[model samples]
Target: MTSRVPRRLYLTIVAGALIMSVAMGIRQSFGLVLGPGAVEWGLSLSTLALAIALHNLVWGLAQPVAGAMADRYGATPVVLVGAIALAAGLALTALLPGLWAAMLGTGVLVGIGLSCTTFGTVLTAVGRAASPERRTAMMGLASAIGSIGSATVVPLSQFMIEADGVATAVTNLAMAMLVAAPLAFAFLATDREATQAPATLTRQLSLGEALKEAAGHRGYILLTLGFFTCGFQLAFFAVHFPSYLVTCHLPVSVGAAALAVYGASNTFGSWFCGQLGTWYRPQYVLAWIYIVRGLAIVALVFLPKTELVALGFAGVLGLLGLGTVPLTSGLIARIFGTGNLGMLFGLCFLNHQIGSFMGAWAGGWLFERTGSFDPIWLATAAAGGIAALLHFPIRDEPVARPALA
Candidate 1:
C-alpha cells in the first residue's frame, strides 16, 4: 500500500513555492534597474554596484539571525515581514530620487525582506514537515517555483522598463507583492501539533560554537566552499551579462532572454536535481555539478564571442546554475538534523552572499578599470574549478549532541 502525503505537508510546500516565486522575482529584477537608474541619476556603475553589493552582504549576514529567529519563533511572522518589506522597498524606490534612499529601499530593506521570506525560511518550514525521503523533492519544488518567478518576471520587467518608465515599472512590481503576501497565511496555517513541537532553537548554539562544529565537519565545509563558487558565478553573470552583451554589440534584450532562460531551466533543473539527491550522495552530485559548471565556463570563455554563443552559454549555464540548490540544501539536511537547519543553512547562505558581493563588485571593477570583462570570466572559471575540488574532501556526518550553555 502506498503512503499518502499529509495535508499539512502539501499545503506548506505549495504555499511556500508561490510566495517564494513572487519575492525572488522582485529581488532578481534589480539588475534591470541598474542601467535606467544610472542613466536617470547620472550615477557611476560602482555606486549602484556598491549598493547591490551591500544588498547581498546584508542579505547574507542577516540570514543566520533570521533563521535563528524563525527557529526560535516561527517562519510565518518572518515571511510576513519579508513580504511587507519587499513591497515597501520597491514602492520607496519608485518615489525616492536620492541614492541613499534607493539604497535604503532596495539594498537594505529588500535584502532583509528576502532574508526572511526566501528559501532560507521557506525551506526550513518545508524540511521540518517533510519526511526524509521527501525533503529533496520539497527543496527542489521551492527552488523551481522561486525560479519560475524569475522566468516570468525578468522579461516582464524588461518590457515594462522599455514601455513604461522605470519608476512605474517598479511601482507595478511592488504592487505585484500583493499577490505574494496572502500566501503567507498558508505558511501560518500549520497544524498546532507540528508548530508546538520543539525546534533546535530552544537552546540554539552560539555562532562561535556552530562555527566550530561546521569547521570540523567535512561535509559542511565542502558544502560551504562549493556554495561560494555558486554565488560568484551567479552574481557576476546576473549583474554583468547585460553590459557584456552591450559591449559585444548585442541588444540588451538578449541579456534579458538569457537570464530568463536560466530562470526557466533552473525551474526544471532544481526539481530534477532534487530527485537526484534523493537517489545519490548529494555531496558527490554537488561536486560534479560544480565541476561541470567550471568546464562550461572554460568553454564559454574560449568560444567565439558572439550573441549566439553568449545566449547559448547563458541558457546552458543557467540550467546547470541553480541545479545545485536542491543538492546543497538536501545534503545539509542529510548530515545535520533539522533542529537547527535554518541557522546552519543560513550560515552556508552567508558564504553565498560573500561570493555574491565579490561577483557584483568585481564585474564592475574589472570593466571600469580594464574596459573588458574577459578577466572576470576567466577568474570565475578558475574559482569554479577550485570549488569543485573543495567538495571532494567533505565528510558527511551528523554533529554530536553536546551539553553546553
Candidate 2:
C-alpha cells in the first residue's frame, strides 16, 4: 500500500539527496584528476593512492560524529559546512603545491566534507522527515538520486578533463558544490514535524560499553565484517578500474564507460533495494545480494574485455555494488531505532571505510608491484562470498529494552 507523502518531506528528501550527490560527485571526480595531477606533479601511483586512502579513512571515521551532530542539531548547518568544505578542497587541489598539500586538500579535507554531507547525513534527515512506513522507500529514493551524481559526474568529469584540462575540471567541480548550498537552504526552509513518540533516551555509554554492546550483537558484528568487504571491493575498483582497463589492451574510453555503467546501474539498484525491502526482510535480501555479487565478480573476472562484455559486467556489478547501502542502513534503523542511529551506523561505517582504505591503497600498491589486477579481482570475489556468509546469521529483530529499575 502506498503511504501518503507529505510535500515538505518530499522537498527535504530531494534536498538531502542533492546534497549527497553534489558532495559525492566532487569526491568521485578524483579519478579524472589522478592522471593529470600525477603527470603535473611528478607523483607516483602510491602517492595518489595514499591521498585516496586518507580520504576514505577520514570520510569513514567522521561519519558517526557527523551523524551525532545532525541528530542533536539539524542537518542544515552541518551539510552547509560540508558543501563549502567540498568546494574549498577541490579549489585547493586545483591550485595546491606538492603532493602532501594535494593529499591534505583532496584527501583529508574533501573526505571530511563528504563525511558530513553524503548518504549518512542526508539519510538521517530524510528518515526523520518521513513516516515510519515511508522511511525505507524515502531513503531508497534519496540514495537513487545520489547515485545519479556518481553516474553523471564520472563522464562529465572525463569530458571536462578533455575540453578544458584537469585543473579547470577541478575548478568547475568546486563551482558545482555551490549549487548544493542553495538546495540546503531550500530544504531547511521548512521545519520538521516533531515526533509524538517519547524521545528515545540514552545515557552516554562508555566506549567500552558501546563496543561490548556492538560485539554482542551478532548482526551488528557480521554487518561490520561484511561491510568491510564492500569498502574493499568498491575502493579497489573506483581507484584502479581505469588503469586496469588500460592493462587489458583497451582504450580509456572503456574504463570511463564501465564506471558510467556502474553509476547508472547503481541508481536502479539503490531504488530497487528500497522497493524490495518493503516485502522482504532486509537481512535476507542483503545476504542474497552479497552472494550474487560473489558470483558476478567471478563471472566478470573471466569475461572477455570487449566493450559490451566489460560494460555489462560493470552494470550488473554496479547494481549489486551500491544497492547494499539502503539495506544496510535500513537494517540499522530496524534494529537500533533512529534515535542513536547516527552513532551506531557511524561505527558500522568505520568498518566499511577501513576496508575502503585497504581497497584503495592495496589496489594501487599491488598493481604497481605486481603489474596485474588479477589477484585483487580474486580477493574481491572472495570478500563478497565472505560478506554473504557474515550476514547469513544476522538477527533482524530489534534488541530488547532494558527492564525498568
- Model 1 Cα lDDT, one tens digit per residue, 1-405: 124347777788888888888877776777777888777656787788877777788889988888877766778888888778878877786788568867888778878888888878888888877888889888887787778988998889889999987888888888888667777666664424334654543354555666676778877876886788898888888888888888888888888888888788889888888888888778777778878887888887787778788877877776777778667777787776666678888999999989998999889888999999889888888888888788877766656665434
Candidates in order, TM-scores: namely 0.92, 0.92
Q: Write the per-residue lDDT of candidate 2 for residues 166-194, one digit (tens) a residue.
A: 77888888888877677775445332332
CA lDDT of every candidate: 0.79, 0.78
- Candidate 2 lDDT score relative to the true structure: 0.78
lDDT at position 326, candidate 1: 69
When summed lDDT is taken over every stretch of 10 residues in candidate 1, the lowest stretch is 189-198
